[model samples]
Structure formats: structure tokens, C-alpha cells
Target: MKKVIMGNHAVSYGVRASEAKVISAYPITPQTHIVELLSEMCANGEIDAKFIKVESEHSAMAACVGASAAGSRAFTATSSQGLLLMHEMLHWAVGARLPIVLANVNRAVGPPWSIWTDQNDSLSQRDVGWLQIYCESNQEVQDTIPQAFKIAEQLQMPVMIVMDAFFLSHTFEIVDIIEKEQVREFLPPYEPEIKIDTADQHSFGNLAGPDHYMELRYMIQEAMDRGLDVIKKVNKEFEEIFGRGYGLIEPYRCDDAETILVTSGTVSSTTRAVIDELRDEGVKVGSLKIRVFRPFPTEEVFEVLSKAKKVAVIDRNISFGAHGIFYQEIKSALYGRTDIPILGYIAGLGGRDVTPKVIREIADKAIGDEQPERYINWIGVKI
Candidate 1:
């Protein structure tokens, strides 16, 4: 059914469609609507799931870990500090090899106390071994949930579906709500060979001696390596069923372009508008929206970026003292493959509006021969 829904509720609907057996989350700004709707669904019997009202975000994730270990399809949502609070447990979920899916409404971290949209919160958890997929719209956010479950359970790794805070979370959009019956075709019930079964009981996350710990870590990496192909396959099957699909990375009009804008999340929509405007002005430009972050689409990124003469990455989050998070990943992806001057522009932090003009400025800077005065340029900063 087609419906105009907020991004948060869209995720809620996806969880419902997935037939998730356990949903536990502590509400945080711009992310509360997701769980709030889930709570109502539970209360109204719309979904056959247990909604655990946990005290803190930490406990929320812990509960999810416990439920997932018991072979339940677990899910949760959070933002900014809430995600940060779940840091240790984030590791717990990964180490335990549970297929819990988390929807993180990307928000800026605190110091000045901003609750607006940014990718820092989720990006900070990059190394925790969760498969991270950033969304460009409400539709994608909703759609990715069931796919996340399939991918997570397949690889025995948690998946984090991230979206901009207010930009996507609060904003409403028309989405084709995939019915549960159809979603079930794409995402089958998760029945892991290993679960907290009393009959076939075995210890999970038990003490591993140093001789075995390194190999276990290697196996996780091995799963991540397999996940790249699994993700593509799952997305392909999803499209076959739902008629909508998103690739690992979306490259727009880059075939004959001299420069490209690299972006993720809602900001990519604005970047697309800028691409068209520049094209009208006789400038060869394009945009690449990174829908998948973790299991970073290295080959796909290399293929698209190698064609462009120069690439400008617009990141809404910074790694602080290093580079824009996405920028670093892009460079790493392209390193040793091409000398296609991949530039970095840090914009939209703490929810600052990254208007089209800002994107234009970044594009102009990227195409020029001034050689980017610095590795990372702060776009739209007043100072």
C-alpha cells in the first residue's frame, strides 16, 4: 500500500513486515517515533512481538542481544549519545554473532548539545564489525530493515541502518509499504544453526584462549568479505519481489563527467539537484550516493570513481583530527587504483543545512586547479 509516512514510522512498518519477534529500544530525540509506533503496534497486536521498555539505551541493546541469542529476531533504534552509550554492547552484539538489526537516526554528538541530523553518531561505530547501510530517503530506510535482517542473520553479524536525523527521520514521504506477506518471501525466518537452545546448549561469547581468539576475529572478517556479495544478492532478490532496489553504491550520470560529488543519506538528494544545475551550465558533473558504508563497496566505488577526473566527497560527519569519515573511506577505496584527486568537503554537521549553493561551491573548488588548499574543506562555515 502507498502511504505518506515519516521515516521513523516507515522503519516501524518494516519491522512489522519482517515479523521481528523482539523489539527493544530506548527513545532518543528524532528517533523516538520509531519505537513509539512499535510500542503501539505491540499494544494493538499489529505485530506479534515483545516490546521491551528498557531503562537506558545500554539496557535496550543488552536486551536485544539476549533475545537474539535465544534465536529471536531482535531490533532496536537510537541516536547520538544513545548510540554512544550502546558502544560496549555494540561490541557485545558483534562478538556474540547475533543478527540484531538497529536503525540509527544519525545525529551529531554533543558538547554544544545539538540534536540535529549528522552521520557522526553512527560512523563512530564503524570498527565494531556491524554492517552499516546509510539511507538516502524514507523509502530506502523502510526497505533496508528486512534486508538488514536477512543479511545479518546470513552472516551472523548485526546490521545498522542509518539515516539523517530530522532530514529523513521526521520528514514524511510517500513510500510503498511492502506488505509482510511479500517481505517474507525476501527475508525468510532466521533460524541460526547456533542459538541459545537448551537441548543443544553451548556457550556463546565464552572465554576464548589467545590461540583461538585471533582465528575467531579472522572468521568475522571472512564473513564481512562474504557479506558484500550476500548484500547484493539480497537486494537483487528484494527488487525481484518488491520492484524497488538500491545497489551497494549509486552512481548518477558519471559516464562522461569530469567531476563527481560523493555523498550519503538525505544530503545526496540536494547534491543531485546541484548536479543537474551544473550540467545545464555545460559542466560535466555527477553524484554518487553511498547507500552502503560498512563492507564498504570498495570495488563499486573504485569502478565509478576511476572514470571521473576529480571527485568531491561531501561528508556530514568528521572523524576529528583525521578527515571526514566518508572522505577517508573514499580515498582508501581509491588509493593505489587511480590518481583521481578525491577531494573532501565537511558540511552539514550538527544539522547545518547543506544547501545546493554549498554543494556548488564544493564542485567549483573540486574542478579548479588550485589543488585543494587542504585535504578537507569545510563548506558553508561562516568563519
Candidate 2:
């Protein structure tokens, strides 16, 4: 059914459709509406699920880890410092190999106390082993939830569906909320072979000696290696049922283009408009929207980007002492294979507007440059 809803409610609708058994999350701004609506759904019997109200994000994730370990489909949501607070438990969920799905409203970390958009919080957890999928629209945000659970259960890893703070999280959009009956056709019941069962008890996440520890870690890598194919398969099945689909990387006009701009989350929407404007001007440029960040769709990215003479990465995130987070990933993805001039542009942090003009500037700079002056360029910094 189609409904005009805020992005947060879209997440709730997704979870409801997926039939998540245990919903645990603490209320944090921009992300609070998700759990708030889920609470009402549980109260109204709209969703037959256990809603665990916790004091903090830490407890929220811990509850999800416990619930998931007990063989229940668990879910949670958070933003910014809240996600940062769940850091250790995030690893616990991964180490325990529990398939818990989380939605993180991308926000800037604070000393100045900003509660607005940026990719810092989620990208900071890149090493924590959760499969991260960034969404460009409310529909994708809603759709990714079921897909996340499918991938998580298949690989026994946690999944995070990230949306931009206000742009995609608080902003209202017309979303085709997939009904439970239809969603079930795409994502059936999640039944894992291994889960915490006291009757058939076994230790989990125990201290592993060096003799056996490395292989356990290696297994995670193996599962992640197969995850690319798993994601593709899941997307194909989801599309077969829902008639809409997305790829690991959505390359727009990249074929036969000289310069390509790379982006993720809501930024991709504006970037596309810039791409269209440039195309009208006879500029041979394109845009690549990165949907999945983890398992880093290296091959797909390489195939599209390697053909271009130059690639520009637009990040709403920054990694201190280096370039943008996605910029670093793009560099690592194409390092030795191509000598193309890869440029990094940082814009739209802390809720700053990343308008079409800003994206146009980046594209113009990329298209007209003989060689980039530096690896990373700040788009609109006052200094």
C-alpha cells in the first residue's frame, strides 16, 4: 500500500512487514519515531511482537543481542551518540553471530552538540562486522529492512540500514509500504539452525585460544565474501515479488562517461539531478550510488569506475587524519588497478544543505581539472 510517511515510520513499517519478533530500541531524536510507531503497533496488536523499552541505546542493543541469540528475529534503531554507546554490544552481536537488524539515522558526532545529518556515526563502526546498506529514499529505507534481515540471517551477521538524519529520516515522502503478505512472499520466515538453546546448550563467544581463534575470524570473512552474491540473489527475489529492486551499486549513466561522481544515502538523489544537468550541457559525466558499504562491492565498483578517466567521491562523512570514509574505500577499491585521478569532496555535514549547485560545482571541478590539486576537497567550508 502507498502511504506518505516520514522515513522513520517507513522503517517501522518494514520491521512490521518482516514480522520481527523482538523489537528493542531506545528513543533518540530523528530515530525516535521508528520505535514510537512500533510501540503503538505492538500495543494495537497491529504487529504481534515483543517491544522491549530500554533505558539506553546500550541496553537496547544488548536486549536485541540476547533476543536474537535466543532464536528470535530481533531489531533495533538508534542515531549518533546512541549508536556510539552501543559500540561494544555491536561487537557482541557480531561475535555471537546473531542476526539482528538495526536502523541508524546518520548524524554528526558532537562536542558542539549537533543532532543533524552526516555519515560519521555509522561509518565509524565500519570494522564492527555489520553489513551496512545506505538508503536514498523512504521506499528504499523501508525495503532494505526485510532485505537486511534476509542477508543477516543468511550470513549470521547483524545488518544496519542507514538513512540520512533529517533528509531521509525525518523528511516525509510517499512510500510504497510493502504489505506483510507480499513481504512474506519475498522474505519468508527466518529459521536459523544455530541459536541459544538451553536444552541443547553450548557455549558461544567464549575465549578462543590463538590456536583456534583465527579460523573463527576467517569464517566471518568467508561469509562476507559470499555476501555479495547473497545480496544480489535477495535483491533479485525481492524484485521478483515487489517489482522494484536495487543493486549493490547503482551506476547511473556511467557507461560511456568520462567522469563519474560517487555518492550514498540521500545525497545520491541530488547528485542525480546534477548528473542530468551536466548531461544536458554535453558533459560526459555520470554518478554511482553506493548502496552497500560493507563487503565493499569492490568488483562492481571497479568495473564501473575503472572505465572512467576520472572518479569523484562525494562523502557526507569524514575520517580524521585521512580523506572521506567512502573516499578511502573508493581509493582502496581502485588503488593498483587504475591510475585514474580519483578526487574526494566533503559536503553536507551537520545538516548543511547539499544543493544542486554544490553538486554541480564538484562535477564542474572534476570535469574541468587537468589533475586534482589534492586528494580531498572541502566543498563549502568557510575557511
* TM-score per candidate, chains pooled: 0.98, 0.98
Tell me model 1's lDDT, rounded to 2 decimals. Answer: 0.92
**Model 1 residue 223 lDDT score:** 92
> Runs in model 2 with CA error above 4 Å?
373-375
In terms of lDDT, model 2 sits at 0.92
Cα lDDT tens digits, model 2, 1-383, are 79999999999999999999999999888899999999999999989899999999999999999899889999999999999999999999888888899999998899889989999999999999989999999999999999999999999999999999989888899999888888888877878787778777888787899999889889888888989999999999999888889999999999999999999998898999989988999999999999999989999999999999999999998998998999989999998998998999999989899999999999988888876846579999998
Residue 189 of model 2 has an lDDT of 87
lDDT of 1 at 212: 96
Predicted candidate 2: what Cα RMSD to the true structure? 1.0
Q: What is the C-alpha RMSD of each candidate to the true structure, in Å?
A: 0.9, 1.0
TM-score between model 1 and native? 0.98
